[model samples]
Target: MKINFKNYIASIFITVLMVSIFSSCTETKEEVTLLFVGSFTDKKTGEGIHVYEFDTETGKSTLKHTIDSITNTSFQRLSPNGEYLYSVVDSQKKYNGKVAAFKVDVPNKKIDLLNIQDCGGLNPAHLAIDSSGNYLVNSNYSDGSLSLFKINNDGSLSENSQVLQFKDSSIIKSRQRASHMHSANFSPDNNYVFAHDLGADKIRGFELVKKQGKVSLENPKEIKTKPGSGPRHFAFHPNGRFGYLVNELSGKIDAYTYSNGNLGFIEDYLTYQQKQHIYRTADIHISPDGKFLYASNRGPEEDTIVIFSVDENSGKLQLVGHQSTYGEHPRNFGIDPSGNFLLVANMYTNTIVVFKRDIVSGKLTKLPFDISVKNPSSIQMKTY
Candidate 1:
C-alpha cells in the first residue's frame, strides 16, 4: 500500500479521541456532598449561611458560597429530599424572629430564597422538617413557644399554623424562671414531634394529628427531668427505639426508650468526666450505624466531644472516651452520611474542625483541616 503520512497522523488522532470518549463514558461519576453551616452574625449582615464542598474520602472541605442577605441564621435543617434548607433567623432583639426557606443549587453554588415567614415567636433557636416534607416546627427560646408550619408544595413555609406557648418554670430561677423552648425534633417515624424546654426542664411530645388532609400537633406528652437539667437537644437512634437528651445546664445525657409517642427514662450519663460548675452541653448525635453517640460540651471549664458506645440490645451508652475539639466552644457537630468523618463547629474559635471517624472502633482522630466560619451554630450535611 502507498504510505501517506498525513492520513496516518489523522488516523492516530481519531483512535486516541475514540478511546478517550469511551473511557469518559464508562467511568463512574463522583457524588457531590455539601456541608451547610449556619452562623450568628450582626444585625442583617455578614455570612449567614456557608456552603462547603466536602470531600468524603479526604475529610477536607472547601468553601463554595456564602449567603449574606439572611442574617443571624443560628440554626438550620435540610429537607428530606435535600432540595431545600430551612433556617431560623435569631436577631439581636428578643422579639420577632423569622424562619426562611431556600432552594439549594449545589452545582451552581447558589441558594435562592424561597420565602420568609414569621416564626410566631421570638428568638427561634432550632427548627425541624418532617420526613413527609409537609410540615415544619420551630422552637422559640425567648418567647417559650413552639410554632408549627405547613410547608407549601414549593418548599416555602406557610404562616405558622399553630403556636404553643409554655409558661412553666423550673427551680433554676436565673435560667429557668420562664419557659425557654430551645430545640425541636421529629420522631424518626414522623409520628410525633418533641420540643426541648430548657427552662421548664422537660421534653414535651406532641402527636402529629392529620385531620382532613392537614397536619397539626396535638395530645401533648411530657417527660420531666431534673429541675436544673435544662433539656436542650434531643437525638434519636437510627433504630428509633432509643433516644438521648443533652441537658445544657447539668451536662448530662439522659437515655430513654422511645415507644408510641412516649420517652421512658433508661439511665443518665454525665457528659463531663469531672463535674464543672459552669458548663453547657450543646448538641447530641448518633452515628448512622447506631454504634456510637457523640455529645458536645461548651464551657468556661470544658470543650470536648464526649464519645459513647451504644449497646444495641439494651439501648444504653458506655463511655468510649473524649476527644478535645481542638477549638473553643464546640457548639454543634455533624457526622457525614457514610459515618466516616465528624465535623465540629467551634463557635468561639470561629473554626470548623474535621475528625476522621473509625467505623469499627467508633473513635475519632482529629484531622489537620480547619475551616474558618464566624460564630457557626449549626452543621448539616447532604449528598447529591
Candidate 2:
C-alpha cells in the first residue's frame, strides 16, 4: 500500500474530536437536578406526585415524570441519602390517613412504591425521618396525635411503633375546640422529637430512646405559645441552637432557644407588615447557610413570603423584607439545597413560582418563569 501521511493525520484528528464530543455529551446528561412537587389530586385537575428537571445554573425547570394514584400527598420528605422518599396521604376520616414509602431512582426520575402503612390517626399532614433513617414520624392534624414507624431495609414502612395523642385544648373556642397536631420533627441532634399542636398552642418535646434496638419516645415536655398563636410548623437553625415556630392563625414566628430537648421562648416576631390584616401563616424554613429565614403567609389579600436576617450570636431575627408570591394561597415554600433559589407552591392558583435568592441580603427576586400544576401544595428538591 502506498503511504499517505496526510490522510493518516486527518483520520487521527477526526477520531480525537469525536471522542471529546462524546465525553462532553455524557457530562451534560449527568448534571441534571431533580425536583418533586406534592399535590392534592383532583379528577378534573392533575393528581399524584410530579417530578421535574431543575437547572440550577439557568433557574429554569421542566416537568419530567408523574407518579399517579396516590391522593392528597400534601407533604413529602426525601431520605438523607436520597435513596428513598416518604409522603403523608392527608385524609379527613378518622384513622384513614396513610404514610407511604417509595424507592427513589434519581437518574431516571422515577419512584417505585415500596409499601404503605396506616398512619394511626386522622389528617396526617407532615412527615419526618430521623438522621439514622431508621424511623419515620407523622403528625395527625385533626386527631391531635403523632405516630412513629420503623423503616425497613427495603424502603418499606412498618406499622406504628409508638403513638402519642394530645387531649389538652387552648382557650380559642372555634379553632381550639380540640388539639390539632400539625407537624412532627426530629431535633437536629436526633436525641429528641418535637411535635407542634396548633389547637393546643403548644410545642411539645419528647425524648428519643432506644431499647433492645427499638426506638421510642419518652420524657414529654411542653412549651406554651402566646394564647391565640396556633403553632403549626417548626424549623431549627443550622446551628441547632435556635428554633422557629410559625403560628398559623396569628401570623407570627416564635423564636426559641433549643438545648437538650428543651425549648425556651426567645421572642415573637410577626411575619406580615400589618397587624390588622387577616393573616394565615403556613410554613417556615431556615436557609441552608443559616444566615436567613423565610416564612409563608396566606390570606385573602396577603400572599407573601417574609424574609428575615438571623443574628448569629443572639439567634434573633431582623425583618429583611417581603416578596409577594403573585399567586393566591401560598401554602408552602422551600429554599433549594444550594441556597440559591426559593420555590413557592400557590395552591389556590395552581402554580409554583421560583425566585432568585440573594444570599447575602436574604431578599428574593421573582423569576420570569413559573410552573402551572394542579393544586401544588408542597415542593421538595433533591440533587443526585
lDDT of 1 by residue, 3-121 (tens): 89999999999999999999999999779999999999966677899999999989889888889767799899999999999998855456789999999998876578999999999
The lowest-lDDT stretch of 10 consecutive residues in candidate 1 is 87-96
TM-score of 1: 0.92
TM-score of each: 0.92, 0.91
lDDT against the true structure, per candidate, is 0.91, 0.88
Best by TM-score: 1
The RMSD (Cα, Å) of candidate 1 is: 3.8
Model 2, 1-384: lDDT tens digits are 897999999999999999999988877545557888988875222366988989998779988888777778888988888789888875554446888898988777878889889898988889989988989899999989999999999889999999888897887788988999999789999999999999999888899999998989998988889888998999989898999999998899999888888888899999987874556899999999999999999976788999999997899999998999989999888788899999999999999999999998999999987999988888888778
The clash numbers for all candidates, in the given order, read: 0, 0
